[model samples]
Target: MNYKTFLINLDRSPQRLADAKKQLDALDMSFERVSAADGSQLTPEERACFDKNTAQKRYHYDLTWGEVGCYLSHLKCWQKIVDEKLDYAIILEDDLHLQDDFNKVPELLEQLKTPWSFIKLGNPFKPRKETPVETLARFNLVRYDKAPSGTCAQVVSYQGAKALLAARSLFFRPVDVDLQWQWEVPIKILGLTPYVAGHNLSFDSDIQQIDQRKNKAKRSGVRLREQLRFFYHSKLRGE
Candidate 1:
């Protein structure tokens, strides 16, 4: 279908913009650059809300200002989609490496059997259930047992945008986590395996200067708690 594309880019990162443009140009794809909000630019009120709304504080050990800014940037895109009344939009971060035939994704979307609120284009590490996939022409689509992480590339429908906006109005978790906890929001989320678009590993993260690793020792307790919660919600309750 005739969908609009938005690339989340920061003004300070010219190299990322250049690289994104080069890839899109190669595929003859068009997109509009949605200027990303820098974490350092968060106003006093935004910062206060960021501090107050954090849901996973136990696991969210030291979320930097940049991470909050990144979350807000994605929120801005979702708002744009809802405000514009678009059927759906393709959302991409600046660090994508599109597959050779990535340009044909629009055609793939046209053939979807069911209307989807969210469709993840990039491959995830390991979706929760290891369920069978409903094969499309050139890709596999599955409603993962767990909401997949990574917002590298995806398509979000107007309803999905609205659902997400409403779900996180009080706003506490990371953007990816906000979307991943599907039971909290109740949106239709689908994942595409053999990713049509993936991230370029060479590009460093705008949110982190160094490797952002969580302390495994500290994470064990929260991780176990979350695992049980996921099990109860996803399998036991069959939600």
Candidate 2:
């Protein structure tokens, strides 16, 4: 259970950071705050990882700047895990509500005898097909047949961090979506359910706002392509 925890928060969003701090403090879980990358202010070096043409070709649509920034923010956390040689690390976004049982995560992980790379601690918005892997005292560890959206909170092992960092050159999809591409990382993403954390919904999401603006300007062909990809992945590929 010796692990580091990082909370990603935009510098302009001090209120969100304060809110998150309150929750973590109550749990007596100390964490480092990782300054989130602001898409609007990305440096040339940070922007180098993103290519509009590549994004359009891979995701069937142009990624919003916010989405790209979000991915970069996560990359910083993964790099930290590798640099510090952490056994595992909990990465958390600023807007979240941690359940009381969240503190028992270490105990839950200790029950696992086999190796695990990534485990999501947050709840999925919709129900997902998953097979039970272990029955812990307060939560069940399950292997997601199809990983869900959202990067609100997750525990990533050193191996998971390395795998994710190795695939950074191919960054196109959103971080959450990329995590679902198990073939890319070749990691089995697991989940803890019933979830120990969830989105705090009170704060408006900057990424959601950016997504809305981008969606309004999407081309008809891009929309169609997105629909096709969804169908292929969900129905055909059974992912």
Candidate 3:
């Protein structure tokens, strides 16, 4: 394949990176490891991009610093794809377990008849609706009604990379959640059935922050409002 592959890895998480590397080696696939942005190490200027008021308005809650950093990490991958003039690139988070047929990616991608902004290779959660587009040798390409919840593995087109980068400049939620807002992004996102990869079952997530606010005492009215907004986004908006 002419496309490049990038694996996001934080410097502090060398063990995770090493584990991912071994899997890639087993698949005989080469990739460049991009240093992930650590939320705790953001500078003042970078931190300013995460506007609290906007985040609260969009998500009905403030986005965690780790979420901001995770969003930035994916944005960086998009920027690199654009700046390097690559046609498209497969992006992988450093905690995926590759399926045996993962090596057939290059060949299978050639079967795509339509242009796609993003093609999710791993689906941690199945979408409510999926229309089969093409039946490849080992997997079927499907157009999904909603974005899946993981950024763990996906192939991103150059145009999709640019669009996502521009749209997410002032992101208001976690990277995966933000992706679910397709109305805001305006791009074609596809999925591969019987996913090529999935999250490593043995590994715990490092990027997602646990919410501590659930234990706090809050007014019923405020709590009710948050639930309504969530329902609007997740159900009404189909995010």
Candidate 4:
């Protein structure tokens, strides 16, 4: 399969980059390292893409700077895919540990005869409901009734990147959560399982830590409101 592979890593996290390099090198996979967008350092133009009012109405809370940066970081990869006109690309966050079967990903994707835009390389959050779409030697490509969480790893096609870019110039939700709104992007989301990648729990997540600190004082009702909004979108709206 002809595709590019990109690993997102913050310049501040050289150790994580090194670790990722070691793992990918051992697997004989080639990838480019994308410097992640640091929330604290977003330029005026980058920060303008974040819509505060929309975030409050849709997510029931303001997105932490970390979340904004995370979203922008993923956007960089998407933009690259569109600009370069690549067939597809495997995008990986620094915190993931790829499985041995990761090499089989190309074969798995090659078997799909139907149209596909995005395919997650790992599982979603708890309570996943998957319908098998196709089976390969080491992975089963499935569609989720419930949209998956986390941008840990995914295979994004040129069309997928174009669709996402056309969806919005301004975003209100986290990148992963935004992906769940297929009604908006109008793209079918798929996944592979058993997962070809898993989180590397050893490395602390700066985004999570920053969010915890920022939302520590958040009201209990905020959590309930967020849940209700998610249900409405995913269940009632069929997003």
Q: Largest lDDT belongs to which candidate?
A: 2
Measured by TM-score, how close is model 3 to the native structure? 0.87
RMSD versus native structure for model 1: 2.7
Q: Which ten residues in a row have the lowest lDDT in candidate 2?
A: 209-218
* Candidate 4 per-residue C-alpha lDDT over 192-218 given as tens digits, one digit per residue, 9 for 90 to 100: 889888788899986875555366344
Q: Would you list the rank order by TM-score, best first?
A: 4, 2, 1, 3
Candidate 3: regions farther than 4 A off: 209-239
Q: Best candidate per TM-score, number?
A: 4
For candidate 2, the per-residue lDDT at 225 reads 80
TM-score of each: 0.88, 0.89, 0.87, 0.90
Report how far residue 37 has shifted in candidate 2, in Å.
0.6
Q: Write the per-residue lDDT of candidate 3 for residues 1-239, one digit (tens) a residue.
A: 45888999988889989999999999899999999888778888777778777655445556666677788889899999999988899999998989988878877888778667788899876554778888876688887666778899998888898998878777766788777667677566788877889988777766553333344343566447755765676576554
lDDT of each: 0.76, 0.83, 0.79, 0.83
lDDT score, candidate 2: 0.83
Please give, for residues 108-220, the per-residue lDDT of candidate 1 as tens digits.
77877876889888853455553435777657777776666778899998889999888765566667776766878767678766678888898988877522435212446
All models, RMSD in angstroms: 2.7, 2.4, 3.3, 2.3
- What CA RMSD would candidate 4 show? 2.3
Clashes of 4: 0
Candidate 2 Cα deviation (angstroms), residue 130: 1.7
Q: Candidate 2 on 18-107: residue-level lDDT in tens?
A: 999999999998999999999888888887787667666666556677888999999999999999999899999999999988888877
